[model samples]
Target: MIPDVFAYERPETREGALALLAEHGDEAKVLAGGHSLLPLMKLRLARPSLVVDVARLYELSYVREEDGFVCVGATTRHHDLATSDVARASAPLLAHVAGQVGDPQVRHRGTLGGSLVHGDPASDLPAAVLALGGTLVVEGPSGRRTIDAREFFVSFFEVAIAPDEMLVEIRVPSNPGEQWAFEKLTKRAQDWAIVGAAVTRRASGVGVALINVAPVPLRAAAVEEALAAGAGADEAAQLAAEGTDPSSDFNASPEYRRHLARVLVRRALQKAGF
Candidate 1:
């Protein structure tokens, strides 16, 4: 499938890309690694008049420790995250999840910021960040602002990023020794999860986030509350899908997704040492 004709601009610097985005407004689409947007364009699902390429923004391609969190530049690829020593040491669960996204080729080409901004409920990274309690940093003509992961993901395939805003970085707490687990229930090795759960257990409480269990990536609030209230893993797992609204597809019924949520949450919590 050939995409409709569009102008392509490759900006060498971050500010340049943002400027193009601002100039083109709704007519522009930022290209990171092109894994998500290119497919949409080829399928004619997206038809932006201009394509702003930011994949060469070298400054936005690092994983490092800062303050008490790990700051990952928005253009950092999944393979980079998966193999980054800083990311592995500071946020092991995130590194592990990055390794599990798509396949080797996809990981090499998919950017963390692109995946998050793409706002797919079925993507692994969104739910991982939700469980890790991360924040997104965005910049636009108004300057920079930070948004929590919970607030960033608004609905199915939708995010809080304005048309002129570009996600700059991902900030996740440096939970160096926290027990964490990610369980993906996919039909095939490289497929998207039918249901997935991410768990991070610390002395304070448990953080649980679910993938493909709602229109947006969902935090298992009911399950977390139950865990904090002294209920066992099995008891808390019962509430895993209590507040979620799973989507039914050919591969899974909503009821089946709910069931997988309960089961996967239990297993994930157990792995997290609940």
Candidate 2:
């Protein structure tokens, strides 16, 4: 399972990378940490003509706070997020979830943007970001625009990002000292979740998001709504799988995933002080 031969370019600047994308369009693929894209390429599921590597773009590898949000560069690694004081203070749920991703090697090389853009329903970071109510910033030939995390995942393995656009930053509202928790059922320590739930309680309200319970990383809207209407965690969690369409796989059946969703969501909500 080798990838097809492809031209490679390490862009020195963000603009340089965008220029390459604009030139090659759908035939080009942007490479960040390579944890996500490289696997697809190696499997021959993705056969791009060109790879625009942005791994060396130092400017896009930072975690900082600005205007009441924690802003993370697209190239910021999961290990960085897990260890950053800024991330820990402003977005503890994200920091914790980042630490929970894969093993140490994957955390050190996987970028937050890469994970989010991969749009995997079972990925930990996307569900965490969704629960945190984060936003994604993308830059392309047209310039930069912001997209709500809720609207970013379009479908299974699809995101709102266009071929010519590259995600640049992730913004989550600063929630210093917030109550948050992430719970998941995994077969092994580093295995992907059979079902995962991330919950956060900010001044705004409670946010609940689930992984591997639908075609996309899903916000448990029924659970959130029930909570908003004065329901207890136990009652709200009953609706955790109400709107999901989880698939039956060797790891778990759809019914089993739905049951896990309810149980994990309750655990997360309770831990988050809901």
What TM-score quantifies how close candidate 2 is to the native fold? Answer: 0.99
Q: How far out, in Å, is residue 265 in model 2?
A: 0.4
Give me the runs in candidate 1 sitting further than 4 Å from their true place: none
> Model 2, stretches more than 4 Å misplaced?
none
Q: What is candidate 1's lDDT per residue for 1-274, written digit by digit as tens?
A: 8998999999887788889988989899999999999999999999999999898888999999999899999999999999999989989999999999999999999999999999999999999999999999999988999999999999888999999999999999887888999998988999999999999886656789999999999999999999988898899999998988989899999999999999999999989888
Clashes of each: 0, 0
Residue pairs of candidate 2 with colliding backbone atoms? none
Local lDDT at 98 for model 1: 94
lDDT (tens digit, per residue) of candidate 2 on 1-274: 7899999999898999999999999999989889889999999999999999998998999999999999999999999999999999889999999999999999999999999999999999999999989999999898999999999999999999999999999999999988999999999999999999999998899889999999899999999999999999999999999999999999999999999999999998899887
User: What C-alpha lDDT, on a 0 to 100 scale, does residue 28 get in candidate 2?
Assistant: 95
lDDT for residue 225 in candidate 1, whole number 0-100: 93
Model 2: per-residue Cα lDDT at residue 145: 99
lDDT of candidate 1 vs native?
0.93
Lowest-sum lDDT 10-residue window in model 2? 265-274
